[model samples]
Target: MSDFTQQPQNQHGSHQPYPGPYGGAPAPQPQPVRNGLGTAALVLGVIGALAGVIPLLFWVAGVLGVLALILGLSGRGRAKRGEAANKGVATAGAVLGLVAMILSVVGAVIVFKAASDVVEEVDKALDSASTAPKDPSTAESGAPAAEETPDGKPLAAGDASVYDDDLQVSVSAPKPVEAGEYAIGHTEGNKVYEVSIVVENGGKKAFASDSLAVSARAGAEGATAEEIFDGDTYGKGFTGTVLPGKKATVKYAFDAPADAKTLTVEVTPGFDYNPTQWELTL
Candidate 1:
């Protein structure tokens, strides 16, 4: 018999090799599920939704929302095809992106409407100011000449001062009056005079009589005259409203130096009106 070596053999009688300690060629590792797109979509959707509530950020939110929606849809398709994991995450990202886009549109609309309204109101106010009449006395130059009466002279008693609005104010000639022994605002050496002031509202709107003001100066020295209060016939000033085409009259007493020959009275209809003066012989 020829010399022979024993070897492991297969059932078919062919030589066979022994298996290695390490497992058969390591089973190909399953490729890591590609979920990057899904994750990115979710992140962008969350950011877009957060910004959507702010009206000023509507543009940013709209852009992010569109990107999220596109990426999420692609990711979901990949998940369906077994290319990516996190199918639920991809779907939620798409829904959130849609919500963010809707909010952005609403916010943008509100912002636009508010801006338009503000612009319109500003335009109306400008128009009204431009069309309103201006008073020469209140002009930029502020010249004393602009404040002079139309006739360039102080009005005489019983003369009416007509305003730009057609309202008229007049004062009656001063008449001597006796002060009650106990009356208020009387100076021992002063003479008392009573005068009537009349305000006529010729404009379409009612005139506010309460806003009327009257003051007087006595003699060439220009001393301020004191107003007298005698319960019976003096001290009541202008009051109530004067309707269109109506008149309001009030009587007032002033105390002046006994030798005063003239009383210069000034009348103002309202805060907006220019003061007008009258010269009254006392």
Candidate 2:
């Protein structure tokens, strides 16, 4: 009978028979596999997200993170191919990438808001300082030159003497007054009025005791009053001295009438300042 179990032998004088069901030769072995792409995507995504290096490029990193996450969710099917990477890393990358994208948008908004505030503040300062004598020539000659805007336009009521960048005072008008509007800088409705001034020490350094005093006049003839540096003025009034970086918010109101046509506000916002003082008119 034909020998079913006995297969042909090797020709090189070997004892092993040809590979077959009965030949006893080693069975064919599958090739080793790897999941290198998934691991790499996860790592790149995580690094991008944490570093915030390319916030504007979130789409790229986020996409990578998602792709890695998908592969990881597959139960590490390719790990059997020999790429001994972890599945958790892919998920973390996805989470971080998404977070980075959201934070980037928030950060952008904050930056824009800060920039706009600074610009508005500077404009107000320039406008208020408009009346300031610019031509050392004319000012020395005692001729009242026309006020100019930052870019040299006719000064507007929005003019302010204090710039937020140079100084930031959280002023409280004791009585409700427009903080930064046309009606600001005056107590009277028509612009003529007495305005009590108060500057709050809202920074991180010692400011001079006189830094909080402010004065206002109606058409150069309005009544003016200072927050008395009395015992009652501490902490919340002009009376107390500001400590290094401590707060000294002053509160006081002035007589603002509805019939006046013009008013001017003045103050010195710093410790070393006894600056000719700043003025804003409305």
Per-candidate clashes, comma-separated: 0, 16
Model 2 residue runs over 4 Å out of place are 1-32, 53-85, 131-282
Clashes of 2: 16
Error of 2 at 151 (Å): 22
lDDT of 1: 0.81
- Candidate 2 per-residue lDDT over residues 82-132, each given as its tens digit: 444554554554555455556556555666777899999998667556423
Error of 1 at 140 (Å): 29
lDDT of candidate 2 at residue 213, scale 0 to 100: 49
Residue-wise C-alpha lDDT for candidate 1, range 58-78, written one tens digit per residue: 988899899889989999999
Mark the 10 consecutive residues where model 2 has the least summed lDDT. 135-144
